[model samples]
Target chain A: MGATEMREPSFLILTALAGGPLHGYAVIAEVAQMSQGRVRLRAGTLYAALERLAAEGLVASSGEQVVDGRLRRYFRLTDEGEQALTLEARRLRENADRAVARLRTARSRVAPA
Target chain B: MTAGPEAAYRRLLRAYPASWRRRHADAVLGTLLDQADAEGRSAVSVADVRDILGHGLLARLHLLLDVVPGRVRAVAGTAALGSGAGLCLALLLLGEWLPPWAPPSTREAGFGPFLTVGPLLYAAWLLAVAASLLRHPRLARSLLGAATLAAVVLPHVVANAYPYAGVERPSSTALAPLAVLGLLVLAAPPSRPSPAVVAATAIGTVAAVGGPMLPLWLSGGSPFPVRDFFYYAYAHHLAVSAAVLLAAGLLAAVAALVARRPAYAGGALLALLPWAVLLLAVWRRISTQGMSALEPLVVVAGVGAALAVLGGLRALGVRVRL
Candidate 1:
């Protein structure tokens, strides 16, 4: 709620919804694909995260469609959600950049020595 | 066996609150079925079942926390602090008023005539609570931690220095207030208190205070004066169980009203399952002995059950609204 550190599942869920509105299963599939199958979002965890994100205005109901006689609700990121995602992305990028920079500096020192 | 996975999944989903199921059950179930189909599995995986059950309950608890008002949390926090302090004072007074013929275990650990270590330690705990209330949470937390540590250590020291036969060292009840205060300070955010913290504090305080008092009341009474420690322990457990049930019921009723959702009330009733089982056990024990010590517990159980049923019915589409 305070824009604190987002958990990996939540971050990935937001990432899955970044491209377009996706139904629950689609989002789960996309998240698995995005994480290279390292992180599989279960139905319960996915829904819970979606509910919290929705409550926080990071996501919203785009629409609903029936596929194979079962209802599938689509969720899309709101403007606020997109902004949050962008900020989180920037934060992660910076952290990665700093780590890489430190690694490069250490490598240069070791090589010269 | 054909419907095994779906049925199992549905049963697991029962862990979720009714309101949540009303909204997302169909879609979630569909997704689960889709995943099963995609993975070439015909049954719900053990991992999926565990995930559903674990996260479902947590989700409901999170929702429950969300419905509890900030004002209610603050009030409950204050009451917990007050009750903790009151219990300390009562224990100190009891030590002072212990009759000469009382059991040696009931005697004060022979610290001194007026000023003893236990009272001083409790006084320090009170100061810590006051500090926390005054917004000096860091200092208060440290002091409380120290006080609790002292409480834990002092008993061992006393046991070694002045060992007495049949002297049961002070129970966790003696340190409950400090523990509650510690929980409050730790769980409370800088800007606001979380609902989980408030609920835990409220429930913990009730259990800490009511647990001891109920046993005392039952044992101190006329019809069935239970003097033995065994009976006292049994009565104490019954009282604590009843208190927990009553508290859960009350919380559910209030949450239902505040959230305007009958599901919260139903959840509260669900919380009373253990209490009901405990009540039956108490009834069976007392009924065998022709004892009427169960009247109070029965009343509490009745009230809790009524509240739960009312809420559950309302959630199930009953026309009643309050």
Candidate 2:
């Protein structure tokens, strides 16, 4: 609730909207592409996550348009969303650095030293 | 135009809460259609439907958690206390009703160990409940955790030497320890139970204890004057039924009081589960004994119909503010 940590889908959703405002389908497509098709955002999950993000002030509705007889609402990441994403990225980076450093030390010790 | 993938996707979107659907249903349906078109598919996939339903329900639960955290915790505590007490009492009554020749010593001896461990475990449980009532959340959680662990472990130690060796233990008897554990886990949240929850739990425990004692009191130390009385009169069957019906009535009242609140609605349903288990046991006994189950069956049908009607009305956009 306090942006302690973002789940993978939420992280990707925020990342998807980082570049510019995108409609629902565009955000889904962008997230799938960002995750290299490993994470497919279903309509329900995407919308639910979007709703939560909006409630948390992490996302905001930019506008809406009628595309092919359907309503397409556009959303963009808010300043809070950007800050949260940056914090999460830094946390992940720090964790990864620690793990990699440990592995390097282990390898060096085992390499005929 | 024929109802196609779009229609199917729209139907799936209905699984979301009404407020959620009102805001995002069309948007989600549009996205689903776009995804289907991108995949060159004509119908919604099973995975899509599963995702919709699973996420929708999770979102609803999250909303409930957000709205009524305290009420939810109180309901959980009440459920744990009520069910755990009911199951322990049932086991004690069952031991009492076992025949003289059927390894009675094991049960009698079992009580010695039970008296030793039971009081300690019960004291811990009481302290936990009291702490919860007094708003001492940390104390309540710690005591509940210890009491739950002791309860789960003590049963095995107390009944180690075949209390039911010569007799076929009713499978339902095995649910007691599990119920105790579940009750503790659910009720151990760091929140004070409301006055209504406390009152309901006390009433529920009293009803549970009194239900089994009613038939004994009625029989007045003499065997019940009816055929298959052991099955119906002295076997705790009537007691369990009475207990279940009483608990169900209480839960129904709570559910009605908090009809508009999703958290209480879900919690009330969860608290009614012990009653459901007891009802099933009674139904099984009634069927096995070939007794007139018409009355009980009618009660079950009536409750089911009422729930179904409520659900249907809710689905029809009726604001269930009862």
Candidate 3:
């Protein structure tokens, strides 16, 4: 299956990765912001998803930092996550185009009246 | 706020299963701290903490249900028993409610005939229990039933008919019988009911009896009626007797199932012997006092007869059904 078949968290995490490599907390914040404040990932859930994605060779963790005396681990999407995200974006664009075409046809008919 | 929010978060975390904590607790804690900081708050509100904790607990609860072994979860039954015993003791202590049929003569304060007869009957009960536990572990389930009989059921049997001395002491005597029952459980090896038989018998026997008795009991009715006071205490007696008999029968069935295992035979023996002795003693006590005084001797005779019949039937190559 293509990248569009990936889960919502993987999709959002890939979208967050578009900004660049981010630590666990930063990734969670960026995902929420990108989703228009709709998706807030708990650290536990995020780490769990990260662990799975890393195991699947789609994401990799790199370089930990000590911030406020707590360890913060950074994560970066691999070539696989990027390729998957590209496929998903293409699928979304195709679907959006079809819907927009249908809307334009309907709007042209309504405009005459 | 340092201690307060941490304490509040810890309190919320308690809902998570210990196993889940061992695996992912630090990560969850890190998340909570991050969220609080992102919101620019030194302390998380109780409601937010509760929401987070509730989600964690919900996940743990599902894990507990799906992943934990039934035996590990069954230990909660012991806690339930402890709570139930505590509640009963508390209620008994708090309420001065006398037995509806407490004859005026039961309170001869100083132990009279009851001291001698009670202990002996208890001993006989203990013996039978040990025997049953030895011969068939399934019968040991009746140990509690026998204790209940001796403590609750038999007293009602006697109390129903006669003007007994120190009737006021039955509730006090309750602890001894309950102790005897607990000891019997301890003396026996770990006894597990066969799942198939336990499920069938529990539904058929325990539920059959307890299902109705519970409603009656909750409504403040007597469980076992003193026979002579039967009219007034019928509902109570019926409920108590049903619970006692049903319990005894279920235990007996369980003991029988366990008896098939040779390893537990010795413990089962220790458990049964005392029970039998108590039963015989009870038979003796009740027989000696009332028209039922002949009852204990008659039971001894009947048991002998049953044995004789078994022997006779065995000699004739006939299998007699109990």
Candidate 4:
């Protein structure tokens, strides 16, 4: 979609990596859990996002390893990425606050206030 | 504990690029193993293997796309270079082989010498291709086309200009076209980047023993050397030049690995190696006796090419301090 709508998944991905470096599968799992299972990521979709972020110099590759006969790669967010993530989170919180106030006002009117 | 699963995992890992694997393959595998251990012995299944394979492939593909810009249509220039190179190679082969097989009249009429058409044409073609490359740039095809065209024309020009008649194959004359060709070899497009990787287990395969095999079929030279202008001036010269280029290419590739910047490494090796080798040869000749008559013009051309590249890069907004 537009730039305004594109920030959600990126922010979520960065947040998932913020705790520490995480492999592809771990990042997907962590993000889903952190979002209360509201944001399950497909392998294609998650890696696609990871690639874009890496190109932008946001997320850097930490390392890779094999466990249980599967290859995995770990990534960590850069300082610039962390700052951008912080800004996005704040912007989102502000918007959410405005929506909650608007909903409250609408409920009062519906209650005959 | 299980060798079969580990081997399978390593095979799956091989799908990624070597550079990427160098950085992360081990960590990734370790994490996978940790997860498996946490799940216990009965945890493994076919689906898990499929998921691993699918994810590894996706990861590698994503990495490949990272080298180019995200805009699909805009990046078509690189794609054009690749195709152009292939077409040029095919054309080069046809130009080289078809002339011998042609009627004597056709050969006399310059059908055989038509291979020379490419180099002159390439000067214009390369400019256009480079413009297209830097502008909408077909990443691989444009370069490949230019190189193939150069290969055809350049060798023929050298052959015609200085017949390296048998027993008197002048080293100086023989090195000219090759030196020129070597400068442009790495810039010529490559086949698409390979995705093969190696896993942590099964000895990890960091060892191999094989020399760079010459492109024999493509060369198609007769077993015995000929004293004719065709063999001396053209064939031998081309063969030597190609071999030198092959050496320079290996040097460039190694430099790329060391530098961690493929483009810079390739450019450095291609531009410097030939000039260095030629410069040394020229210096040695001048020290022994006197400079060759063509030295002045060669120097001028070399300087001019450098300036042209500088100007082009400047116009494209790439700053060149020197």
lDDT of 3 by residue, A20-104 (tens): 8887778888889888888877665676677668867878877666666455667788898787788888887898999999999
Greater-DockQ candidate between 1 and 4: 1
Better of 2 and 3 by lDDT: 2
Tell me the spans in candidate 2 whose CA falls farther than 4 Å from its real position: A1-4, B1-3, B56-104, B107-320
The DockQ assigned to candidate 2 is 0.36
lDDT of 2 by residue, B183-204 (tens): 5345436364555655565556
Q: What is the TM-score of model 2 when looking only at chain B?
A: 0.47
B1-322: candidate 1 lDDT, tens digit per residue: 2467777778878889898899989889888888887888888898898899999888676565544333333433444444445445544443222333444443434444312455666676677666755566566667666766775566556452233233333333344334534443333222232335334544554554445554453343332222222233344454454456456556755776678754444444443433444454455555655676765766667565656655565554544422
lDDT of 2 at B37: 82
Worst 10 residues of 4 chain B by lDDT: B201-210
Q: Put down candidate 4 lDDT per residue, B194-267, tens digits, no spaces.
A: 11210110011011000111233233355312212122323333323333433443454355547665444333
After best superposition, candidate 2 residue B124: deviation in angstroms?
18
Q: Return the TM-score for each candidate structure.
A: 0.52, 0.51, 0.36, 0.36
Interface RMSD of each: 3.2, 4.0, 10.4, 7.4
The window of 10 residues in a row where model 3 chain B has the poorest summed lDDT is: B75-84
Q: Kindly list the per-residue Cα lDDT of model 3 for residues B1-322, writing each as its tens digit.
A: 2556656666677767787677555555656666777877787665565566666766665564433223322322222122223223322322222343444443333234332234433443344334432444445445444544565445555442234344333332233324444443433212433334323422443343234334433444333222222123222322233234323433543464366532122222222322233334444444444545445444664354334323432443333333
Error of 4 at B255 (Å): 34
